[model samples]
Target: MLIAQVTDPHIKAEGRLAYRTVDTAANLARCVNHLLGLKRRPDCVLMTGDLTDFGRVEEYRLLRRLLAPLDVPTYVVPGNHDEREGFRRAFSDHGYLPREGDIRYAIDDYPLRMIALDTTVPGEPGGIMSDERLEWLDAKLRERPDTPTLLFMHHPPIVTGIEHMDVQNCANASAFGDLLERHRQVFQILCGHVHRPIQTLWRGVSVAIAPSASHYVALDLDPNPRREFYLEPPSVYLHYWNEGSLVTHLSFVGSFEGPYPFFDEQGNLID
Candidate 1:
């Protein structure tokens, strides 16, 4: 299976720039078109969140319009910037809220089961999974004990080594990790919200955080409040799962001027 993940577009109503900064919607559209133009199309496109900058009804409407060109199953979850009801009404038909009482869904599509979990906490920047949602996850895992499952969400369940973002991450990460520890079938966990591409391992499964389709969060190895990313070129992650192994690749859009390197099959230098 092939999946393209776009995160944290932070789209605005007027197609305006965010914080006098990035033109998120335009960047997102570029990434989408890049995916659409791929010779080997992805099976589906998964959006990890921050679909809108302020989570307004009009924002969602505009977002829906902007995303209409893609011809594949597009699944989305809410980020800190999203309103559950507003997001639902604009995109899905499941009563404008997650049918599972939480923004969680299971897509049963071959060798791997895709589970999208809602990590948005209303009025709060951080996220948490309630006891009820945890129970549901446990039950769902039990139902398909032997199936390989790939979990998706907005917040990374592990710390990203950045101070500010670390505080706003999933609060119940330990509990969530415990649940995954108990389920051997859960093979991968994919998330967003950090605005950078990151990878880690939690509970014996591969955990990946997709980069934003809009602005990037500067990768400062040191922890500092003054740190943030510039409006660098937007990017997306393409995940390929064959049999039970998962491989992820990053794709950047637009013109990039770099060193020219030409390689020969069995010869000397060609650059």
Candidate 2:
């Protein structure tokens, strides 16, 4: 099964640009087109978070229009930039999303069970896994202990070397780590808050952060680095589940060089 992970699109309202510079809408359109153009299309799309820049109704409306091109099932969780109420209202038609409360749910239809965790803290940049949310997650993990599971959320619980982004990572991650240690079925945690592609191991589970579809947070590791972003090449993470394991690939969006063969038609090395 192929699952395309697209995160932090940060779509804005019509005629608006994110941070007064990035054309998030156009970037996302290109991303959607890239996904559709993949030779082996994704079975589902997991939009980790930051679906909109301001989480406003108009932003959500435009986000929907941009993502409408994707025919596969797309699941989303709220990010720090997303307003829960606005997000709920925007995707109310999606039956998988709960009508009220935090945006959290589980999908068992695929070979790999997907558990989406809501780590967003209202009015705050950082995220947390409250006791209630932890308990709910524990219960969900227990329900399918034998299934290989993947947790998708907006905030990464690990600290990246980038100090600015690390400060806004998942708070109370120690407890969350303990919870995951108990659930051996969870093989991976997919996230998207850092705006850069990163991967690490926490609590014995592989955690990957997909890069933004627009601007990427600058990769500065200084003690007092300023919060900055760059108009880098947008990309997505394609997780392919095969032979009972998940292999992820970073697929950059936009046109590039040709797929030249390494060998000639006669199966000889090309000079």
Candidate 3:
């Protein structure tokens, strides 16, 4: 199955740029348009979180309009910047996610099972999975014991080696990792929020995090308290699963504008 993943759009109600610098909403729209222009569209689009810069009704209205051209299904979960009530009210009718508190469901088609978890802790920059969510996940995993599952959440369950981000990561991630260790059917875990393409292994399975369409977290591994991001090319992830293997490709939107060198036709000459 083909799944297009978009994360941390951070659209504003006023449709303004983030931090007075990055035009997040416009960047997201450009990314979406590029995805639509693809020759082979994905079966569905999965937006991990931070759908809005602030949880405003007007922002979601704009988001819905921006999402109008998607012929395929679009699914979303709340991030730290998202208000659950606002998201539920705005996207309730879409039928992509369960019409209830903080989405949780499994896609019954194709040999794969996709589970969306709510890890957003309200009014905070971090995340946590409540007991109810944990119970639900355990039961759901048991119910589909044989199906290879792909778990999606906004906060990644493992550290990304970036100290500042690591502090604000999932609070109950260790427990979640233990849960994954017990459930062998889980094939991969996908997430957002680091604002960069990060890959690591947890619970014997691979976990891949996609970069934000607006800006990227600066690649720094310093132990300092303060951290920052960089203005890199906006990107998305295309996850392809077939048979028993899964591969993900990171794609950046727009053409390259840089210098290049070419070798001579003789194949022995320098650039």
Model 3 regions more than 4 Å off: 257-271
The residue-by-residue lDDT of candidate 2 on 23-96, one tens digit each, is 99999999999999999999999999999988899999999999998999999999999999999999998999
Clashing residue pairs, backbone N/CA/C < 3 A, model 1: 218-229
Worst 10 residues of 2 by lDDT: 164-173
What are the RMSD figures for all models against the true structure?
A: 2.5, 0.9, 2.9
Q: What tens-digit string does per-residue lDDT give for candidate 3 at 1-271? A: 7889999888886647777888877787789888998777888888999988888998898888888877788878889888998999998786766766666677777667889888988899999876777888999899988888998889988888888888888888777878888899997988999999999888798999999978888888878845777889999999988778888999897777764556666775573
In candidate 3, clashing pairs total 1
lDDT of 1 by residue, 1-271 (tens): 8988888889888657888778887887898789999888999888888999899987888788789898888888889999888887787653423644567788886557888888888899899877777898898899898988888899888888877888899888788888888998898888989988889877788889988888878776676765577777788899998867889999888867975666677675775
Q: Give me the displacement of residue 148 in model 3, in angstroms.
A: 0.9
TM-score of 2: 0.98
Q: Which stretches of candidate 2 lie over 4 Å from their true place?
A: none
What are the clashing pairs of model 3? 11-53
By TM-score, rank the candidates, best first: 2, 1, 3
